[model samples]
Target chain A: MQNTSLSQANPTSEDTSKPRKARGPKWWIDFLVDLAGIYLFVVRFFKDLFRPPYEFKEVLNQCYIIGYKTLPLIAFTAYIGGIVFTRQSRPSLESFGAVSWLPSLVGVGIIRSLGPLIAGLIGAGKIASNIGAELGSMKVTEQIDAMEVSGTNPFTFLVITRVLACSLMLPILVIFTDILALLGGFTNVYFGEGVSFSLYFSQAFSTIEMEDIFASTLKSVLFGFSIGIIGCYKGFTSKKGTVGVGKAANSSVVMSMFMVFVIDLFTLQIMTFIRNILYS
Target chain B: MADTKSNFIKPLFDYEGRSRVVEIEGLNKSFGDNHVLKNISMELYEGENLVVLGRSGTGKSVLIKCIVGLLTPDSGKLEVFGQQIPGMKSYQMDAIRKKIGFSFQLSALYDSMTVRQNIEFPLKRNVHGLTQAEINQRVEEALDNVGLLYAIDLMPVELSGGMKKRVGIARTLILNPEIMLYDEPTSGLDPITAGEINELILQVQEQYHTSAIIITHDITCARMTGNRINFMYEGEFVLKGTFEELSHIDDYRIKPFFEYNEF
Candidate 1:
């Protein structure tokens, strides 16, 4: 007989459950359970984020896929949206005799609200569904299980990299969206009012505050986190078979879009409260 | 660079001159109200192919999943190499997992990666200080073992079912796993392909001298590859013995299995 040897592995994925109580209605019970699962999943992401054997290579790859690949879609939509919104808003501003205020108005609107919302919605749609379907397919087909058996943590390799990529890439995408949308506004302003390039940009930057950019970036980051987490949670826990994968993909898009608006509402309230307390 | 770090898992030898690598006692698993595994007890000795024969939904997959730390058994003792592994986290099982290779029912090769990348994955992630050439050599060796070196660069979608299974085996084999857990290795294949897979399982055993737990309902696969057999039905073992001993048994639940698959 020959002597057998052993190799090393470090998967670092998640926990399992034993017999537990189920209270309340089935849907309510499932809701609480899912809530708890998402909480743990997010907590584990932070824990695994700092753990050793960091997968920077995979993170970079995900950034390229999530950020670079989605650029074209964001640019086109943001530009078109800028033109349409600016054209509509100009009539109201002109009626109020604020035609000269168009550049500053568009700048504040896009930076403080429009740019982030567009980027958030677009990111949620593209990145969330893709992650959801990809991870869901892996779950059902047992590729994730295969990774666990191989000593590589699928969560770190799959979830953390994706979530981090979304978080890091969204703000950059927003910056691009902000620029392109402002340019779209510029096209409309130049055609409609014959405004010069330098004068229009000067008016745009005059009302822009650093705090506004910071607030928008913060919102973008949160939106990115929601996009990553919801998609991952759905995909990671997806069940049944191909149907489950499809459901995961579909729900990721819907949930992510809803989350972006919900987050927007809450953040709007909090920022308002802070501003009132500071100024009043 | 060379790896100086080593991990050793010494198997426990019983008085009968056989070592039990995996020892399960009173194992039970359930989902919601459905009791999938109930009061199951079994043993797998060193270098032996132990087949857990069963029909669909007999909790065979859950049983092996528990052993591999994919699913936590609701209750019971599951020991691998004398270490208890019930409800343990993934990191806790990593050392033990390196020695256990599980082949899924549907060959779960990483869909995005090529066959070469798939085989190279484990080594690249876990094993340290190996040059690219060394990794490539091990990958080629593993694929060659499964007779799939020709399809190394191809993606999984391009391969046939049997070829995918072969690649999955090659991926696991590349890890140098001491204990192999095959989840219906011959399922979803034609008779000829299934026969080839069974032959491959035997060849892996003969070459690697690895202990394996083959979960299958196919009696021919059991007869061909299992050193001992345990029949699973309704979440419990109904019958167990060597192929010759099980073939002679006169039980109703066991009769149809052999008559249906073996005849």
Candidate 2:
């Protein structure tokens, strides 16, 4: 390792710039490559999913790690977010003489959109970055290659478990988030809006039909799955070096954030369409 | 002496030369303008320890990766267990991969997993339809073999460098792979620890009777564990011989490597 540094008397300016900027191609080409990589990952994952010695135990272990372990962080974030959002939104609503509608409005809005969206973003920060770094380090150490030589499918074992865990557990987390956010709104009504606890819940729940809750919950599930899958994918496919690992971790967060936005827009559109068809 | 008798008495090295575990012929790989492996051809027989010695960037690790189907060569005929590798389907490569084990130089135990969990990972995931008890037994046996039975529950971070390498060995052995590939097993270890690791490699090689191809520039380690050592330079296998024979070679290109103790 020391010899590697001795041979290069000095790094040229171009060498430093290469890491920060992707030269030799237009920006559009780089974007297309990134898009293509995402597409290929999705296609390959589905392709290799069912064929072979199944890694059920690994998937279960991942669920325990990714899903079960992340519970406290998700719950704490959601609880605080709910309380703070409601508390902050209360004065504005009161000035408009809309204090009575606090529970229904905050409850529906938080559960339907903000709760899952913010939760997914937090998951990106917490779970996605972790997955990237962990798998990135594994790549750098050649553990993934070791797995391959040992006649084990590194992808099937490592990638599948993590992706599946995130896909399955993220929905459960979002459900918890939804409940916590509503409780926070309920608390705000009791303390700030001068409404009784039972009255706030009953009124809040009355306005929120099953469709509203379900639509938002569904989006969160997809959001969670996307975050987990993209994070693990980037990390697992990282190049075999220290720099590669850092790049993988950085890309995982960037791609996950982009996916969250894209998925949110599409989900919102579908939700609105459903509402229009049902009510109209 | 009893030492000679004990060494001779150990029938672990005996192999009838039944099958080839790894075969590389006319292999060629290049990274951009720099060629890494050129016309490389070698065969790894069952129960043989083949050590590859090379300087940095000599395609040693790349050669191992190609055998495992991790990286595809530019042009090559590579075969493992009678299956052609260059054109084999991904699923096919996966099937062949199940019969191999790898111990990385960096002791690539998953940081998030406990030592036991790391060892159990390959078996728990790859070997289908095994009962939970069976998996546990395998994990225990693997850890015991590497003398890491006590540290099973500890995370990778808590273990020393030596302990981490042992856990990596146990993980590789969980599947009882027929072939094991080691990449610079002693590169980053202290002399004493490195010796211990070499002993562990010998033990695993003996007990499992698995064919091993180790990539390292450490001459001491190669001498201790290698039955046949191949000297690689500039993407070529410049010399191949038993360690005893290679150490005595008078060739100008190879003699300096030994004379300077540069491996």
Candidate 3:
């Protein structure tokens, strides 16, 4: 009877009925969890970016996709935006006898804020959306997993190359947007206010500083990186199904544009503080 | 052939006698209280075409995932090429994965890349010191083997379903892997195309003589490609045998599956 009871107790002792405890929290728990996922993804991307058998071909492909392919849209919209923005601001300035200040006013506005912001917004629509949708579709179709199975790091191949391309390319695109906006501002001054080309040219540079142009251009780089990385991240980690792809693309542009403004506001504040200490 | 216990028992324990390449013992995986794989065990030898036949949700893909270290089993021991791999680092797994190839069901060809670029991707990813000429040669050879040499410059979108599958196979072949894992190589294709894919699989099997594990539901595909079949049902293998042995088995679920002639 004792032997039988012991045998029954041994089998029962090995029972799988005890509820599995939840994974507990610990020191560096959140850090470790977040590390291997998105944070590790970002680190791996940078590491692979500098490493060789560098996908120069894929980089060129991305340049075409993110920069060259979207040029027409960026150019056309920037031109129109410049024309409209100058014309719209003319009425408001004219009400206060600030009409003679048109060129400097427009120049300051373009270099300081409008130039980077508009280009980033348009890029948010064009580049970010494209990155998200493309990667989202890849994720949904198992193409990303296939890359892993084939011994190719998908993040290195797909995301890093794209992020690098956007980082390198968008600043150049912003430069183009600035040039077109200048042309458009000149055109608006000529057509809307009958100002001479020479007068508009001289007035535009009268008050503009090297710092203003430099700061805005630098900000666009951050804007571009944010857009590129965020877009790629959302798409790369997308779940669910076909609808998930669409959501990723949509969310990428929205979230990136939001972050761009947030960064811009903080940058402006920091720059103001630095300038106050240095020049004032 | 007689319905003997020895044939069934022989292959299950053949790991000791034969040169085993992949040995998975006592695999148990669960996703938040829902058990996906329960005590799954199998051994694959060199140059053997092993097919895992199962219903849709029997963790067939999960099993292959464990082999490749894509999904960690909750409890198990999996050895690949004599390296114990349960909680191995990704870099270590990457070293091991260099000798493995996986062809997905959707083909998973990078749509952003052209056919030539897709095939060249693996060579570019794996080999660093090779010259442009050597890379080009390998890419051409792989594309030629898959019969897609002409479509090199065309985008993945331009290719047909069969052509995409061939490109996918070409990409896998670029790595010259020692083991190949095929996930439903032929599911949605028309019969003729499916047969062509099977022929391609057979051609690869003959030429490379690498160990292959095919996870599929189609009996016709299994019979055409697999040298040995393992019937996976309810998180475990219900029966495992050659096509002839499984056909002769006197069981309910196993009977119609093996004997039914869809071909």
Show where candidate 2 strays beyond 4 Å: A1-28, A51-57, A87-96, B1-20, B125-138
How do the residues A1-280 of candidate 1 rate in per-residue lDDT, one tens digit apiece?
1222222112221223345666556877866877798799999999999987788998999999999999999999899978987898898999999989999999999998999999999998999999999999999999998998999999989999999999999999999999999999999999999999999889988999877887889899999999999899989989989999998898888889998999888788878887789789
Residue-by-residue lDDT tens digits, candidate 2, B1-263: 00112112222334464467888888988766567787787878878898898777778988988888888999978999988888889668767777878777788777767887787777766787999898888888888898888888999899999888888878878877889888888887899998999999899889998999999988888888997777777677766666766676666556766777764
* Candidate 3 lDDT tens digits, B115-209: 88888877877878899999999999988998889999999889888888888888888989889898888878887988888888888988977
- Give fnat for candidate 2: 0.27
Per-residue CA lDDT of model 1 for B1-263, tens digit only, reads: 11112422232222256688999998989888778887778888888898998888879999999998888998889999999998666677998999988899898999989999999989898889999999999999999999988999999999999999999998898878899999999998998999999999999988998899999988888889887777777787766666776676667667887787643
- CAPRI quality band, candidate 2: incorrect
Cα error, candidate 2, residue B248 (Å): 3.3
Chain A TM-score, cand. 1? 0.88
Candidate 2 positional error at B180, Å:
2.8
Task: In angstroms, give how far residue B193 of model 1 lies from its true place.
Answer: 1.2
Q: Cα lDDT of all candidates, in order?
A: 0.86, 0.77, 0.80
Worst 10 residues of 3 chain A by lDDT: A1-10
TM-score (chain B only), all candidates: 0.92, 0.91, 0.92
Q: Looking at candidate 3, what is the lDDT of residue B158?
A: 94
What TM-score would each prediction reach against the true structure? 0.90, 0.84, 0.88
DockQ metric, candidate 2: 0.20
